[model samples]
Target: MKTFVKIMLAATIVLVAGLWFSNSFKALNNQADALEQPTEVIEQPIIEKTKIEPVKKTPFSETIVVETAIKFEAPLYWAVNDYGLIDGYSSTEELIEKYYLEFTEEQLARLFTEDFFYNEADGVHVTASASPNLIQTDRDFTITELNENQYQVSQVLYTLDDGETAYIFVDYIYDEVNNNWNIAMINYQY
Candidate 1:
């Protein structure tokens, strides 16, 4: 019985020592792995390519209404008639001065181009005048942009005496130096 007891004690001590040594070996391996240098991982920046679009220009067109009897229509009618009759004033300068309140010098010059007038005798005759019976109603004018710097204003008028329709087309060009719009052309039919 005594020899049996001593043999059992020796077996238990060996089992415990074996388990302790195994656990110590695992801990040492984990510490070594933690102390080692880590692998380098370089990250590249992400670049996204986007498409750029150009700005598009849009043309302008609109209908306008001048709410008055004939005040707005008188100046244009008088100018066109005087231009056709060639009896308003002597020269372009005189015409521009006379209508300076209505139009600018640059505008008058463009309306009466150099080819339209000749060096003739100076006359002091006023031959063209606006009729008292002419009337302008709502939506009587349409303004359209021909290009980036050019525009056309078309007007329609009616005669109270005979109920006749009249048409007027005026072209305007933007002058960058003068910072204003000048009359490029005028055409009318009564």
Candidate 2:
């Protein structure tokens, strides 16, 4: 009776293991079949290309041609008094000889206008320093034409070792009689 009981217990365990293995195998096969099945593909929409037209010009539109000339820079200079200080220039003649050599007669006359200087008799008075030092060697200047008879001259002056900048703006008007550029106005950046 004892041997029969032991054999019955071992048989029950083997039967349970066989059923579990069979169920696991069936589940694995079902998963494989789901992956192997065919799927429906969706189609993409087609796009059409459009042609571009060139822009047309109207008869009222007129293109003006501008002629740009080479830009020339006037040399940087200091206005010093008779004692070699930056107080006031010695005389109008000295000022003209040093700085206004390129200026036309009309331009020179414009310099004496009542609004041009603080002291007309003294000419240019710069009481800032004894003398201006050149901070950089290269400088840039531009002259643009506002119209056929007028031009604008602009220059940037970097002076002294302290990196100071002085801007000079001058307007030149073309004299039909002389056919040359004449200074109409002169301003400093301060």
TM-score of each: 0.34, 0.31
The TM-score of candidate 2 is 0.31
lDDT by residue (tens digit), candidate 2, 52-153: 854432211001101111111121124344422324455545545554444444454434422222334545543333333211223446656787666666
Estimate candidate 1's RMSD in Å.
21.1
RMSD of each predicted structure: 21.1, 19.9
Best by lDDT: 1
Error of 1 at 81 (Å): 21
Clashing pairs in 1: none
Q: Global lDDT of each model?
A: 0.54, 0.49
TM-score of 1: 0.34
